[model samples]
Target: MENRSDEFSQKLLNEMNALYSLLLLFFYLITQIIAIYVNFCLVVMVFRTIKDEYKYPYYPLLFLIMFSNVLFVAMTTAIAVLGGLSRIVPALAKSFPVLIMIAISYPTVICVLDFLLCIHRFSVMFWDSEFWSIHVRWKGPLIFLITLPFVVLISSISITYSSLLVGVEIDAFGVGNLPLYCFISDIALKSLLGFLTFVGYVLILLRVAQQNRKVGKFTDFTVIEQAFPIACFQLISSILTVFMHMGVHRSAWSFAKVCLLKYAFTQLLCIVVPISIIIGNQNRRKKFRYFCVCLKPNQVEPANHRVCITMSNNRTSTTETSF
Candidate 1:
């Protein structure tokens, strides 16, 4: 009886592992498809807007957001693909550490970029003249340069700690296990960043809402529409990350399950937000309407103007006779 029980338990475990492997492959394919669609849309939008001579300060920030999204998709897809194949490919299995670092770095950079984009939009709407001044642009680059070193230093330290304490080990069948790193510290940092981003975006949303209330018109819905999707994506991604971190520390849940959930949430963001932006543009709607109007033939002009003038002259003559 004891031997039979052991054999049955082993068989069950094997099935679970096989199921998890299939899930990973499914998720990887879905994310790749979404990423390709997003990249194509971004390219089209950028090409359309590139020749505009107006100094729309937000263009650069939009471009940065799109570029970051592309990077996120590419890096994330690579991680998923390589991670899935690590069981079959020894080279990929060994390079898992570097791949993990790249994955983390891509999202970190993207988070920072999202914050900057929100701040840039706020500055443009509230302080248009000041934002456009030459001093602001020059100073901005200097600030980034000054801060770049510190960001690199911090990320490097985190990466080193993560690599050493949480290495990946692969079995002969290509299954990989990644240990959790930074325990309390990682959760705290991620929570802090997530909270900060959420707050910033929420405040911006409130400001826009307030302005819209006063104006009784939404002059530009593009920013508002895009902001909500981005905020939702950021919030969901951050919360899932924290949850994954906690799950890693607990033995009750499988690490693979946590990773699958985390990546699934990420796939949601990569698939939904950018696509919503492209489809929801108010300007694009107007342009489409105008195109339809132009395709039709023009109608004849009204004779009301000439008739009104003749009626006015006759009224003048009648008034003179009555006097």
Candidate 2:
């Protein structure tokens, strides 16, 4: 009786494993394709459709963030392809440790971009000086310099953490060799980022709310208001994903499923987040819609001539003013 029970348990586990392998493959492939399309469209729009006078102060950051997404998606797409193929050619499993290593740094880049934007907005509001304004043209080089140390540090930590992990070559999912740990470095990075971005988002929201409530509010936080949707999405999603991951923190089928869920949420959020940033600004959306329809509007509206777009429980209004 004991021997029969052990055989049955083993068979059940095997059957379930087979089922999940197929599900994971489909999930990875489908999400990667959708991400590629959405990010590609965003890249084109940012470069081609943007009006010169649309002086979105965070334009450089926004562009860099979207472009970073493009690179991240491209890397993930490659991971999905190679992971899918590794099943047939078992030797390919060796490279997953390296690939996942490279892929993990992508999110750190997003965090850096968000932090820079948030800090810049905060500086503008609090300092109210020509500090950031004076070096607007040098924002690119300035960001690169500021973030280089962080990127380097994160990469080193991730590599060290990956070495500590004992990856499974053919886990229940039967894809590439999977990390046995719950992506410890990734969780740490997200946790740190969650804290920083939370502070930044709260400050931005509080300041924007105060400004909006003013009588004839002349100097509203236009940049923060415009970046709010995307920033909010980033914060919410990061918190949720970290919570979800904590629940399934082990090397098992549940762990694989949890990771898959994270990736799915990622694909959805990446597509929505950039669009949210664009939609936050009314004039930009107008030109975006026009460009999508393949019609170039002869007169492109500028951001200085503001068109306010606000939503309160399904209500929206557009109040024009000098931004």
Candidate 3:
């Protein structure tokens, strides 16, 4: 009797675990799909609206950030969905080199971009130089071009090092159990960049305070407001990554929980910039809405109205009008 009871309990537990994994996968797929859509919309919106202005640097910087995010999120979503499907068919477990490339490259690009954004915000707001006011149009793209070589070099080194992670098993949900040493090395680099970005933002804030005191009103805070959420996420996500790393060496159950939390934060990172832009800036929000509209204005407009004007010669002209 006791043997039968034990078998029953084990079977029940196995079923529950299966159910949990299924639910977790559903959550991941849905959230990541939404994130991909949002990030892509932001990319299109920026591309359509980019133009010459003193604050123009922010647009290209933002465009690159969202463009990278759209690609990364789409790749991750595919991997995650396949990760779940692989359980039912072992053939789906095939790993690809692009997975390794993305794992090593995406964070490097994002962290660097985040820091550049902070620097842009700092320079534009804190400095009164002619270069920032007049030449930022070309300077933004120049800096991005210069930074590319270093990012590629660093990512190549990391990928080579990652290849040395023998028997690094990726879970059914596509999360890798990276060794603490590997995780820390990557996190340390990101943390250093994040720290510098935080410092830049702090200096900009102090400068804003000083200017506000003199002018007796808030001045040039829009960009700062837009950047604040991203900076906070960088700090919070780093701390979460540390905790997630700690769980990687533990039990599989614990690691599964960590992966769910990691996905939540990852998707949240993809969504943050879009939400920030939509809420913090009016023009970008309008542009984003414009991009999201499905029907053409002429198709969606109400029935056209006709108007007639009579010229001095008693000639009548008719025009169709639409709003």
Candidate 4:
């Protein structure tokens, strides 16, 4: 009786664990789908809404970031899903390293682009530079041209590095051994970019404070104020992911748990950027709400329904006005 009871208890525990795994897998799939959809919408919205007055490298950079984010989320999802599939089909495991490389490359570009976007915003807000205004026509194209080489170089290196790994072991969670240099290089680059982006935010806030003091009272910084939290969340989400990867060496957490945590961090980062863009900016929010919330496509069109993009001391703000 005692032996039978012990066997029964162990079987129950196994069943419970299997159920939890299925639930977590379902969650990963759902979040990945949501991330991909949201980022794609943001890309479309940013592109379609560009007007003559919206001429700035800021919008272009934003479009690039969202586009990269969509690819990043998609690649990560593919890695995870394929990694699981490789368990049943051994041939699939061979492609895991290549998938890993594709996944790593995007986030590196994202970090660099984030830093560049921050610098551009800082320049326009802190210096109130005429440079962005004066060179408006060429600046956007120039920024893209300049960014292309870095993208190519990073992607090339990632491909080369993944090719170098032999007998790579991929776990069910798609976690695998990265070359030590590749691992350290990735972490270093992201840390540096993240720090610089934070500093840029600080300088922008200081500029806002200076303006407030000159006015002898507080002034509205609604847009900048809203953006601050979103930026912080992105940074924190990114930092936690790095820490989670680092903790893999020290902690006894299972590979599945580590992978899930990393996925959650990444998915949250991807989802939040679009959400912040839609919710933090008044114009984008109204446009998003109008299109997404309204059921009837033929709803009466309002007069003067236009989105105006304005750059002030802190950042570009979108305001929609309708008569």
lDDT of each: 0.52, 0.58, 0.60, 0.57
Model 1 TM-score relative to the real fold = 0.62
Sort every candidate by lDDT, greatest first: 3, 2, 4, 1
Measured against the true structure, the TM-scores of the candidates, in listed sequence, are 0.62, 0.65, 0.64, 0.62
Candidate 3, residue 198: how far the Cα is off, in Å:
2.8
Q: Number of the top candidate by lDDT?
A: 3
lDDT score, candidate 2, position 172: 27
Model 4 TM-score is 0.62
The residue pairs in collision within model 2 are none
Q: Kindly indicate the candidate among 2 and 3 with the higher lDDT.
A: 3
Error of 4 at 223 (Å): 7.3
lDDT per residue (tens digit) for residues 117-143 in model 2: 777677776676454544543574476
Model 4 regions more than 4 Å off: 1-23, 73-99, 128-178, 216-230, 250-260, 291-323
With a 3 Å backbone cut-off (N, CA, C), the pairs that clash in candidate 3 are none
Q: Residues 1-323, candidate 4, lDDT per residue (tens digit)?
A: 44543443344335345666678657767877888777766766676566731654465666666667777776676766766665754433344345444545555566676666676667667566666534533574466568667654544353333322322232322324334454556666666777778778778888879988897767444445434554676577667766765554322123335545544555666777676665556566545643452112332333556765654323556667655
1-323: candidate 3 lDDT, tens digit per residue: 44543443344345347777788667766777778777777666566556622355566666676677777777876875676676744323233334445545566567777787787677677676565454655676677779777665555454333322322333322334333344545667777887787778888889889888898877756666766777778777777776765555334344435545655666677788666655566566556544543212222222443443333222334555644
Give one digit per residue, the lDDT tens place, for model 1 in 3-39: 5434433443454567666877687677778667766
- The order of the candidates by TM-score, greatest first, is 2, 3, 1, 4
Q: Which sections of candidate 2 miss by over 4 Å? A: 1-16, 50-57, 78-99, 136-141, 152-156, 159-186, 218-226, 241-262, 290-323
RMSD of each: 13.1, 10.9, 10.5, 11.5
